[model samples]
Target: MEHTILSLINQTNRNIFLTGKAGTGKTTLLRKIIDTTYKNTVVAAPTGIAALNAGGVTLHSLFQLPFASFLPTYGSVPLANELQRIENRTSLQKHFQMHKNKIQLIRNMELLIIDEVSMLRADMLDAIDFCLQQIRRNRLPFGGVQVLFIGDLLQLPPVVKQQEWEVLQQYYEGMFFFQSKVVKEHPLLYIELEKIYRQTDPVFIALLNHLRENKLTEKDMAELQRYVKPHLGTKTDDNYITLTTHNAKADAINARQMEALKTPVYRYEAKIVSDFPEYMYPIDKVIELKKGARVMFIKNDPTGNRRFFNGKMGTVQSLNDERIAVLLDDADVIEVDRYQWKNVRYRLNETTKEIEEEVLGSFIQYPLRLAWAITIHKSQGLTFEKAALDIQSVFASGQAYVAFSRLRSIDGLRLLSAVPQNGIESNEEVLQYAANKATEGQVQQEWEQGRLEFLQEMAMRTFDWVTLETAWLQHSSSYSGEIGNKNVYKNWAQQQYAKVKELVATAAKFSKQLDGYFRQGASVEYVCERVEKSVEYFIPLLSQVWYQVMYVLEKVYYQKKVKEFVGELEELSNNMGEVVKKLFRLQQLMALAATGKDFSKETVSTERFEALFMQIVTNVNKQMKQEQLFTKDKEEETPKKLNTYEKTLLLWNEGKSIAQIAEERNITESTINKHLIKLIEEGSIVADLDKLFSKKEIEELSPLIDALEEDSLKTVVEQTQGRYSWDKLNLFRKVYLGKE
Candidate 1:
């Protein structure tokens, strides 16, 4: 059954909910999938602690979302109040302000794994969905990214304030992630694991299953009553840790136990090697340990010998600078080594055009924490051989279940207080959902259907030009050149952008035609004919026309000798080159599909892509040389290219307004303004501000630009309601600052 689940995850793009009871190896399965999957993947968790446990980043940090409750912003429906409305607007604006690299990272993702999803609120999931849709520009759930949810629904419930729920109940069915609007519309395939590695006692397992469903009998109560006692052992006992319902109580117990210890205290400080943030520290920066203190292993043995595992209990035998020996329950003492945890961040590699993870820093420390007491919330994901439960005051739903489920067997459990029967049950809605989950037969059928549909969808989307257009737009918006060669390079880039835009529009229409054929149940040969025809039509346009332009840009880039522009040009060229390679790959795959061959894992070879790329480069170079040869023949009659600054200066001296000069020269007003700014900064010419803005407009904007807190032009435009364009504002700022 686990193998079938792994196959579904690897072979198809299906959204799945992978769940099981405690100790069912869900976390272990996640690590396996992350190591083996071929897709570009990212992992996110609901909170920082969970993120650390899952070895991923927080969902909020990954999405750049504010730590505020989100309400739906679509449609004309009003929010609960004006404050909520304002916050939603601000969050939307922040989304717009995301860095291009971060945006690209989200766009490149193929699969997203969310851990500890039981604690994910319905509204928070919706917020994540909205952010993905806006960033990827796709209306499909999670913007077409396959999502895998991992957590048991019976462990812990999402935290929601009473007032927040009062307002949210109008929009959502309940507070669980499964109740979110997106999940409700596109239901996830359920696959629950069955094997329980922590407990081997069949009777204890049956009792736990009954407790999970809120169906415990009188006999089960009699079994639990045996464990009820005033105390499990003395404070010096190393076998049991108190699981309380509140953090303060746990803290007090741990503090009192530490004070009672008369052994000498030894302080150990972690080594921070680099850029790990303080909030994300996995362990304490400084740990104070006594010789007799009880400790739990916070990390697994790094050497793979499995000498000790996370959550294993031990007592400190000896502490020194070089080694710390812990005595385990089996009367064996082993030296614990300091383990290193890396702080990783994602980045897009310009050379390979792929997203990769970079280790920002590392935290090296001994993997132990005091285990005298711990809160039930933090006890999640930890296995215990013996636990003393103080959950009589359990306030949250499923808290008692979580506390009890952490134990390996009924024999090791010691109840310090009577179980709170009212809070010991799962949510009724959750029970119904679990009962109605699709059986294995249904899931297998769905997996077969989904694999077929995934192939067809991938084939159809091969013709889509959205990614190409997006890459072009991002590059054009961020490209800037040095003053010496700014105009020439800028103009060339604009011309290429216009050409790419036209090509993308044509590609969009062709894509829709293919979509129509698929909808109309066209013959495989007919669809292949259409696809082949598109290949013939688009290949030359891309390789010969588009690649030729890039070729020219490359030549100009080198001829200009501008060092700062090289990185930008390389990025843009590689991005456009990837589009061409994809097209060639599409043609090959279609050819294979026409013959009824399996092309599921097929991709165009890099050798073939480079052949096409070099073919274009060679032809373009030959043509340019021929043209230059012809120019050399007519050198006497040819005119030298005028410097852009001198030409703009001539126009400025001729009493031509900025707009008129821009129109006559066939350049943008913004470009013209940039030219003027360069001229002023170089002390070439300084003239009228009246032609650009009226006296009242100038007076109004001058003070705002002067007194502005930040050096942002976009801020200036926002304050004035965009009445002034970016070009005019930039020109004014240059003049005001330079003159003063």
Candidate 2:
């Protein structure tokens, strides 16, 4: 089945719906696709951490989509809340429309891989589909892009509010991502991943499978009750996690555990630099780091080393102004540095077809969470060695199941609720869906056959080039004469583009000479004569008239967005028609001038011209952003092109010493050193041997660095005690075996 799916991946037309229970190698398969696929692809998840785990961006970040719990700001208007909602909808649509880069990415993309699809609402999915259709200019679903959704529908349901769900109810069959309008209509092939990678014990696995399937027997419950000991040692001292249904209870437990520590709490205010939004900030704004506080690592170590995984537990050993020491359960004291969690919004460059990462902002701090206890909802994606569950408050269906499944074995759980009313709370809707989905094999087979038939019909049908069916295809031809065609589209486009350039050059020169105004006979006659004289240039152009054509081209040239001119020509009309229209527009402008029309009045002054230019350019520039011919024509007051972290990476790549980079960036050398040290810790940059220190020096210095008891600058400085300059050691470490 896996091999069949791999073969299916080679085809560009089919959407795949991948699902399995928790720890079922779904992420593993996605990682493989990301590493191997040659297609222009993107990865997005419903949440920030999920996106980070997939090495992608959030769906909201990718599409400029709004999380639809509307915050109204209205006073005294009739139906003001509804009006505000409408206004918000329009604004969000405009937001999506404005990001030309993102729009183009949607249009040009081949495969879009979305993780944690269950958390994705139906409206969000529709938002993506609508944006794609708008950008690609094709009504065929999702701009004809194949999307891969990896998530377990049985684990988590989309959190739709009562009113929102009421609104969405009319449109969708149900709230599952598979039930989303686009996915439901579009024949997505479901591929269930059967292998469970995390839990190997057959008994535990069977219980989970039964529980997930909503077929948990009375025997299973009795067996579970046997593991529910009255007391499971000292919970305060042990590393056992507690799962509660309510946030308040979890917070109380955490607070109680923290208060048990007699040590004074050290309050550290997180330094704000970048434009870090609330959604992306991993830790608390005011981080309270107390000695012996139980903390969980929020980020995986960059080097793919399992030493400090995202959920790894450690205790704060000590803290100071510069650094904090952490002691892990495995008898290792690792120096933790202030980590940077980026909230990046990505866009695909069409010209080069390279994916560019735009840092929206970032949260820089130690990736630690106060993890004494957490709510079951928050613990959805996490696994624990041992867990304590307070199932007395399992208000929602599947809540008990979710809390139970967090543990690897029945032995790891110490349930506080001795007896609940029902054996296991399962949603009736989910149970019904599971029953119906059991026969999904027939549905998928029929869907595939129908899909193949549709494609075959398109291939065999008589060509009516303008129809929506063939619009997704770049170019189409009549049924006959495959061999006789000599690339008409390219040939025609080039010839017409040349004509436009000539006409535009004349108009450009004439505009400057006229002191920004056109006169009726001499200049108008000159422009009109130029257009009338070119016979083949201004012929057979349809859809757009000459005024719009000439007006748009002049705007394009003036705005320095020349790369998108060809695309604008294509948008106006096809290649041959495009050139003719360009010529016609100049003729119309000349005629208007002759008729004493002051079309250039509001556009005469530089300020007005700039305003007019901005209006025209914003719309056209957005379209051009998708065309790979990118330019350096950045907008006024655009944020810094390169972020501080990106700049550090660039300077390091150029082989500039840390000091030189520090001087160039106008920051302290210590800051640059810290940044470089972070790169090393993340395992992104390895030390290059002999670049700063000899192999003998490295061998001698290895133990000295290790004896400091943590990978931190403060500890290193403390150990050296000013005998050796820290810069020498930093330089030495930077180039020491960094290449791997």
The C-alpha lDDT values of all candidates are: 0.77, 0.61
Candidate 2 lDDT, 1-740, residue by residue in tens: 45445434432356777777777777778877766554567889998867866778888777776656321122331233442232223344566655555655665576788998878876677777776776777777787677888887766677776666555565666666666567767757666777877687889989987777767778887888886765662276687777888989888888888899999888766766677667655667777778898877777776676668666777899987677888876678878877776666667643233455677676677777777888888777666677888878777666777787777677777877674535665666655544433234654564445433332222222111232212212323321242322232344434444544445454345334442322232444554454455423323222223334434454455443344443543344323232332344334434444454432223122232234334444655665654424334444446669877778988988888777888999998778766777666667566555553457767767777656545555666566676445766665555553422
Q: How would you encode candidate 1's per-residue C-alpha lDDT over 222-247 as one tens digit per residue? A: 88888998565425674789999998
Name the best candidate (by TM-score).
1
Model 2 regions lying over 4 Å from their true place: 1-7, 65-96, 230-234, 268-273, 419-421, 431-740
Clashes of each: 0, 10
Cα displacement (angstroms), candidate 2, residue 510, comes to 44
Task: Candidate 1: list runs displaced more than 4 Å.
Answer: 74-86, 89-91, 233-235, 421-423, 466-550, 556-575, 578-740
Query: Where is the poorest 10-residue window by lDDT in model 1?
Result: 597-606
Error of 2 at 371 (Å): 2.1
